[model samples]
Target: MKRWYVWLGAAVSLVFLYFALRGLQLQQVWAGVRTANYWWLVPGVAVYFLAVWARTWRWHYLLRPVQRVSLRNLFPILVIGYMGNNVYPARAGEVIRAYVLKRRERVDMSPSLATIVVERIFDGVVMLFFVFVALPFTPLPEWMRRTVVLSSALFFGLLLAFFILAASPRQARAVYVWAVGRFVPEAWRPRVTAVLDRFMDGLGCLRSGRDVAMVFVTSVAIWLTETVKYWFVMHGFGFSVPFYVLMLMAAVVNLATTLPSSPGYVGTFDGPGIAILAAFGVQAALAASYTLVLHAALWFPITALGVYYMWHERVSWSDFGAAERARRSEPEVVGTEMRDARQREVR
Candidate 1:
């Protein structure tokens, strides 16, 4: 059911993009592309790679409480994961990356997944911060303003929820069990509870103050580097948009990806990218061209690299398919164990 919704959303986004691009002049877009300063593109791509490296380091920080892994070892895996996300839909690359870490480094998938979730929350918050800060400078519409505010609130709310869960795992587990029991059959409740418990254990990484601070700092740095990438891309196209404006737009585009979309975020990404620039008074043709270039900068290289890495690592498609299947078939053993242990203590 959820998967169907993702596909439907992707279709809708594509339809929206088709209409959006229909009346635009191809020649103007071509001119914009032809006039772009290819020199800046090289630096832009390099900065983007730096952003990826910073993100990998942040992930390592998140995993520090459980186990230490070097950024050197993790960087290639991270790149490959991003590549997987571009090639496959439903962000299957994420699961693949977790499986890689689990298989290669012997890292537990639960905590690795938790680290990914933490990474997302940090990304959301930083992106929101940039968007809200740049809102006043850009000539945004009322509707767009409302959307940003609401979206910012949503991400902030998620951050709050994560902290709450991190603060009290035992209570969170109890509440989870009660909720599951209401819907799941009696025979299956215990097993489900176990899985949830294991999942919750992943949140334990957030309990350390040093780790929390490191995650926050690294997240900010990563977003700032991403903003630089956006700025360079704009410069590559000969646009002199303010750095703040570029940052805000970058945040907006990043936020757009949180929605369900096709693999590589095709339509969903380009729509928001063009819209944000147009709102800032960029010409439609230039904006469209900019969107394509920006998308290429972020998606294309990683994908090419990911394909190469996937082949080099000998990660067959069947291996990923099997991982997905295993995830579905396995009982919620981890969560159940935590729940039972808590229950025993309570009694």
Candidate 2:
């Protein structure tokens, strides 16, 4: 299934690349890239790291209910996790990051995974918020609007479900039993339920309205900082869009990254960004060049930093595989006693 996901992502990226490149002059795109002032990228990259720091703080806040991890300690783990996402398929970096947290902070994996899920959902909500904020001024194409609507349904739906799960455990369990109980074998049900309970523990922050608001506020700040990078990079390429348009582009491209794509989000990020610019009246070649450079600017520095942190932390490439195995083994480890008790009862 993992291998299948990798291939599917590659194929999806190829499709996006085709559209991104279609009818564009390759030479003009290269020319635009070659002539751009590179100095703007310095500040762009700097602002991006600030956003990463904010992200670490957000994760730190979310994990506090389960375990109080220091932001200084969490930063490198967050960077390494992002690096893993850039290089690995299926956002496996999420699992790897959670595993690293376990190794470093002695936090349980399921709850950490739950916290990560909360981060993703909030991020999606923020991205969609950007889109709507820009909609009136930016005049997005119909397809983009439709995409936002669908994504809104998904992210909001998830937020509601998680709120229900975290706020009302008994109700959640009853719903789970009604929906999924029969499918799970009696021997495995105890383990599954226990793992889910731990996962819900990760969502403890959501039970408090203030914490949820803080998460949303911090999420908004993160993306706004990232959109600043987009604005800076836009200056480098010698064409300019309004700040809100940059916000729209940032939101659209990042949302596009949520689609299946090759490592580093490849064509998925570039295509939507280019399309957004083109729709906004920028020349296709200029949009392509700017989007390509912006994509690299966004991808490389943090990824390199992540690698350095991985080395400093003594984590290796093999650790990613280990993380995957660890995640799969969590249920077995947590459920062992329950499973044995059921067996004893049967005997």
Q: Which candidate achieves the best TM-score against the true structure?
A: 2
Which stretches of model 2 miss by more than 4 angstroms?
177-181, 337-347
- Model 2 lDDT per residue over 271-290, tens place: 98899899888999999999
Cα RMSD (angstroms) for every candidate in the order listed: 3.3, 2.5
**What C-alpha lDDT does candidate 2 achieve relative to the native structure?**
0.91
- CA lDDT of every candidate: 0.79, 0.91
RMSD of 1: 3.3
Model 1 lDDT per residue over 197-309, tens place: 65666677677777778788888888889778888888878777778887877888888777777888888788878877887789989999988888888998888887787
Least lDDT summed over 10 consecutive residues: which range in candidate 2?
Answer: 173-182
Compute the lDDT of residue 85 as modeled in candidate 1. Answer: 82
